[model samples]
Target: MVVLMRRRLVWALAFVLVLSLTGQEDTAKKPARTISIVAERFFFSPSKIKVKEGETVEFVLTSDDTDHGFHVPAAGIDVAIPPSGKGEARVRFTAIKKGNFRFECSRACGAGHNLMRGEIIVR
Candidate 1:
């Protein structure tokens, strides 16, 4: 009877350990969410965005009329968006900080290039 009880305890402990490890694995393997942005001559569609801290995000930038750029100084993200129907630029970064990060057009598109700006709010 003593030996049987010891075996049962060992199995129970092993099962609990496996369950804990699997839970951690699922969290670690969580997929990142993708956000698409459309850039025009003077503005970005959906200029404001919100994300959770410690979550990963992927940005897909595309142009409508001319060549534009995406620049996020705080997050170290910089990419050039091609012209309409040409192609797109993609960037991925983890939101580690909790604040607002500004993004703007890196390339001079036109006279209103300065107005082309957006913000990513991380909470």
Candidate 2:
């Protein structure tokens, strides 16, 4: 009976530890908010983004067809989305500079690769 009680106690302790760690992770890495961006043949839908200083934005990106990329050199963010798929990448920065930053696809897709660009304004 003593061995059985000890086993139960150990399991209870493990469960509590797992719960606490999960809660901490949830709070620590939570994004300030989420923004959705769509990539098509040659453009990003909602081609312009605006955010405040110190705001952490999670970008949910999807491709209309084939594959495309989202890259912001100034912010050092580059992510690729599978065609018409759901996934997210995050950017967390204190907007030390306030202006227009141009982001483009670092990956070559087709004839419009060079023209695939967008802007982010940080205020």
Candidate 3:
């Protein structure tokens, strides 16, 4: 009877351990995020994104015509948008600073290369 009780205790402990580990893994996984942004000849359709002070933003930037690049200086993100193609990018940051940050395409697209700009407003 004593040996049987010991074995049951061990199994219970093992089950608890497995449950704890599995719960942790689920919490660690990030939430699903999908944000669509339009990229035109020389600008981002939304032009600006408004986000809470601390939030993870998944930006899906797509080009309407030609290929372009998306760059955010403060967030340190650079993504290239293919012509008639779509791309995905993510940025996670705490809006420690409350202001408007600039985002532009690093790549030279055309005559309007200097006009490719966007903004990220954190409040």
For each predicted model, how many residue pairs clash, with residues at least 3 apart or on different chains? 0, 0, 0
RMSD of 1: 18.6
Provide the overall lDDT of each model, using Cα atoms, as 2-decimal numbers: 0.78, 0.68, 0.66
Give a tens-digit lDDT track for model 3, residues 75-106: 65666665563333333333447789898987
- Can you list the residue pairs that collide in candidate 2? none
> All predictions: root-mean-square deviation over Cα?
18.6, 12.3, 16.5
| Candidate 3 or 1, higher TM-score | 1
- Pairs that clash in candidate 3: none
Pick by TM-score: 2 or 3, better one: 2
Worst 10 residues of 1 by lDDT: 22-31
**In candidate 2, how many Å is residue 34 off?**
0.4
Q: Write the per-residue lDDT of candidate 1 for residues 1-123, one digit (tens) a residue.
A: 999678556645644554454345344544378799999989998799898998877677788988888888996566767678766666665788899999999889999999999999999
Q: Rank the candidates by lDDT, best first.
A: 1, 2, 3
Q: For residues 27-79, could you state the per-residue lDDT of candidate 2 as single tens digits? A: 55556787888888899888998978656566666778766777888866565
> What ranges in model 3 sit over 4 Å off?
1-33, 86-96
Error at 45, model 3, angstroms: 0.7
